[model samples]
Target: MGNTMLYVITSLSVGGAQKALLNLASSDFSRDYPPVVIALVEVDGVQKQFAEAGIPVHVLGINRLTQLPWVLPRLFGLVRKIKPQVIHGWMHHGNLFATLTWWLAGCRPVLLWGMHHTPEKATLERKQHALVLKVGRWLSRFPQQIVYVSRRSMQRHAELGYAMQHAQVIANGIPLGNNREQAAHYASVRQELGIPANARLIGSLTRYVPEKDIPNLLNAIRLYQEGGEDAHFLLAGEGMNAHNPALQPLLSALPDAIKVHLLGVRTDAQRLIAALDIATLSSQREAFPLFLAEAMAAGVPCVATDVGDIAEFVADTGTIVPVADAAALANALSGLLNQAPKVRESLGEQARQRVAARYSLNAVIQAYQQMLGKVATYSVSNA
Candidate 1:
């Protein structure tokens, strides 16, 4: 018999939601509460992450989940066969599929839906959002509890009018590895990227998507340099090739003194974080990004846009600027950079302390376990 099973958005690549779910399903929490994972569609690489952690994964080869009304009965068949104690889903697509599958299976398997971002910030074309929003609100009724990566995310859902009394905010946790190779890793990366040894490094780790607003980051860096702040910018992540052709133009417009290293999608994000003098997040919207938490855990001070739960997360440890305002972002970066080294160092230290106290993987997983137990008990009692 399988354990509490989770159906996810995709298992192919790593995202914040994927990383958090994998951490939980493969965590030591399994020793106290058994678990299993089901990927809704064919996904690669993730099986390896799970297998390495001794967690089992099952993938349904559904080509397009957007046509879930047609695809759900088949998924319901799979759930009926597995008979897990609970069915948890991730992202909007995964939540819809899992909730429908649970209802169709004729079993209330302690449905839990994970919302990783504010819906208003989704990449979906605006024309399609109405249908997606309607479906999301309808399906939300079936879940015993809805899990959000940040309070801001939950609030967005409520603002969108998806009222559920069981809504909860459970931020994502990150397990930053030991800083064994911290200095060496940064030195090597910086050298390879051709960044100047003495130049101030201001960096960000984010996928090059429009919502991430890489253009604003480029403009912010320009402002930083224009104000006589000698700096280099490093953007580490892959670009959505077809959509993000703006990157090349931004790079071409820069002077040689301001280096912009595009370290395309890396598993070594922590190493990249360690390589920087300062880090940033200039997204138009977000839900407590992994980059911010990872940078904090790696003891890097950040200046980010006041989006999602960032203001709540940063508190006084880092600077918060308004979204998409390059001038404001540049000013904040300049101020943080110009501070005394000890002052910056102290801020970074406090940032690390905050992450350790509230955002450790072990602590977040324990919270999920308690929530899962409540979900299970409520489902059983109501059954």
Candidate 2:
């Protein structure tokens, strides 16, 4: 009914966590022991990526609290029939759901939980979500190993009383084998957007959310223009559109001199990233931003706020500024904008080299393989 390894994630979307899991699913490590992907909900477009990769995909389609009872029985039945050897959870909700299914199935498969996001205070704002974390922290001990994509996430969870005895840090591995698109590739996007070839193309692949701080980036774009430089910005991701309240007021205030193109939830992220002169993020929080690593891997110079693992990850290859400091972001963007083409190319090459050295996909797969021994001492039933 399903593959040996079961991967449970909150939802199927075109996000970093999903991409990382997809990469793992497509790897040689998975060829020997394939995984059945389970998403609580399905978003359009990305489910096709999983199907194309030859993995079995199952969506519970649980959109609301009322749907939980109806959907969970199907999940439970699937678990009972498949008898997955390993249950790997992605994010908090997924981990809890995996644990639930593991219990109901009466199968003691190896349980591995993945922690991908920062433990910001804002997360505990919801009573229900707050309850989930409390339950997760208490139930955290049952998993064979808890994998944190960033050390900060791991340390933060440990502080929150997660079982640190079996916890380990494994950064999201970037597939470094992708061929960098040539200038012609970016020229196509620039042509479609009506942005001039000479205009500095600064782009960010992020949603219009409080954490992403798109408003801050808009302010920086304004200040950069006020200082006598003209540039075009391409923003893409879920909710990164004209209708988003978090973005509208800021977007309305920016001068006409600065061009901002909102491409909502693009599948061709690599092509878009490659076409840019600079890649940026003014996010308030992050563990390790795979987009920055991907941009760097493509030899694109980056300007990001110093958050989470960014300062350490970018090192000397890219510029890191203080969060919420529009002027500082403006100055950094301007610094890169003013650089000669050759100098920028050299900097971009250096950025690519940094990512190649540390964040390769193979290294991550090996780390996962080491931790993923045979189904723990558990495996009460394979039937």
Candidate 3:
């Protein structure tokens, strides 16, 4: 098996899939076969991290589908130069793009695709996305292998007419350790926000997107507050800051006694996750909620609405509630708070241990490396 692999994805933005790619590419197991990131469009910041990992990154510099024709030449040239033994796509558009590259480059590398989304998105997906999803089903058999981060994603895609013969599930992983030092930083963060020492600091690390259901989280918080509890809520993600006009009214509606601190697009998620008394997620859709896994890794007790593979992973470590039910989410959060400090601390340690045992970064990278090795073998034999 040749130790060269190329990864294609729609964008290199700071999201779960992007972070998973970064973690896999930068890990020690991937040192020999570093990533050749082919982003469909130019996005900020992550390119630098890839470069620092000694991975080559290529951005097509195109925004709309109309611009794809202009970038085909450049894409073909990259494939020719790299001559990767296996070409893997990250998502729907990326899978299609890699398929196009396989045809245009005339370099028959073994092709693979990665699917990170679930069917929950299809309910409200735009026309363009619907078209891509349709195209993916029609062309799903081309990829030698298709990898999903969760069992639910794999099963749903199969029901949607995707080929399942060559598919497998490889869950996302995070760097694991007891983040005592990073967790301690939460105290200073709380102090800066003027939160009383005795107050529970509940934190959520998520992007403010429709699928994430920020409104659902706000409603849950409001319900909890009305139940005679005062807590500090810290939400860190893109469009979560005070500057977002859409989010301001929701923030204003929360009782002044219940503070919600919005820190937009922070790079220090580990520090924030470690310092929290509880971490929560209220997403309407998800595959494998990376934030909860990260929170568990950081030794924070979690209270998340059951979605994706969240219930499977969280298990007995944290509380799970019904999706979109603010009352249930609020009750779960309050239940965690009602526990003794030592009890919560014990649960946090158990959460950290669960993450370490199942979803370590090393295990995931090794799984990818092994899978690609098999693909390289197939490529060589088929050639």
Candidate 4:
């Protein structure tokens, strides 16, 4: 009920969940529940984004997960010093560290775990997720709660044998910026990129990873081109490398006429969305992507694979196709091109309205505020 300090996340890069954390940091809700963010890892470039909103941030400077043991004592010391009302975690590593640190700190700030996805399997860069899950189960004794960005993620966790009752769905929101400015920015960006004035651009804004199914979208584009459409496709995001075995061969194999452009990550996603005639998300697995919400906020008609809670958010507003189905995705994309301008505009309006009503920046922050209050109270009562 009083001002709440939130030790939010610890990540090396500023990704979707980090952006969501930024939105929360920038909210006027501080008038009701003041929030503080502490990144357990070095708080990458996101610190500036929060600082622009006059929010002070703390970084634990955890350089590597292997150094977690070295960081734990300091992390605990920092948490005790800060004594936030709620110790919240954003993604898996952050969640594990925050939950463990809070518990070790005698659960000073109520432990609130933020689950961004169905826990990802271990990769060469990170430890196994099963080990993380074991830690979560062992630490479930604390008054811990979860905030799932979508119901799909919540269901996935339950299917994996985690407690469903402790989790709540809090869909991430898009920042309500100046739509006109976004449009102008898009115009300049398109001009700079050398896109033809009349060209129809289909954009897929996602990290170039295996789960994202970037190849599926490329295949769909191939299908669209083979059927005689001259659409320009842009794939934008950071961390894309054609050298990685998972993605390298596919990039090499793309047809010359397909005209694929990889515009590595940009913070000005709204501008990119504004430039797009249509936005696409070809992920084979998603909980609820901020990209889809962002595209809709820019009033771009979306064609997304029905992977996460996308169907629920996009109901009747845009096109949805089965995951990895090139033909179905191609049909959906083509179906929009022949539609009247007024009709397409109406669809775009619907997409924007959906975001405004349900996924607005204010709405999501309010939900977190309320959830934080409840978790803090619950933690205190049980303690």
Q: In model 1, what are the clashing residue pairs, if there are any?
A: 237-265, 238-265
Q: Candidate 2 has what TM-score?
A: 0.94
lDDT of 4 by residue, 192-304 (tens): 78888777888987887777887887789888888888888877776554444666677777678887767765676777778888888888878888888888887878988
Model 2 stretches with alpha carbons more than 4 Å out:
1-3, 177-180, 374-383
Q: What value of lDDT does candidate 3 attain over all alpha carbons?
A: 0.85
lDDT of 1 at 238: 64
Candidate 3: tens digits of C-alpha lDDT, residues 1-383: 25577889999887878888888878886667756888998867477778877888889977887997888889889888888866888988899998987776576777889898887654427787778888999889899999999998998888888888889999988888555576467777767778776778999989888888899999999999999987889998889899999999988898787778888887767777766899999988889888899888888889998888899999998999988999999999999999999999899889988988888897787787788778768777977
Q: Model 4: what TM-score?
A: 0.90
Better of 2 and 4 by lDDT: 2
TM per model? 0.89, 0.94, 0.94, 0.90
Consecutive 10-residue window with the lowest summed lDDT within model 1: 238-247
Candidates 1 and 2 compared: the better one by TM-score is 2
- Model 1 spans > 4 angstroms off: 41-47, 61-77, 104-107, 121-125, 196-199, 240-244
| Better model by TM-score: candidate 1 vs candidate 3 | 3
- Tens digits of lDDT, candidate 2, 76-131: 88888779878889988999998887787685777889998877777677687788
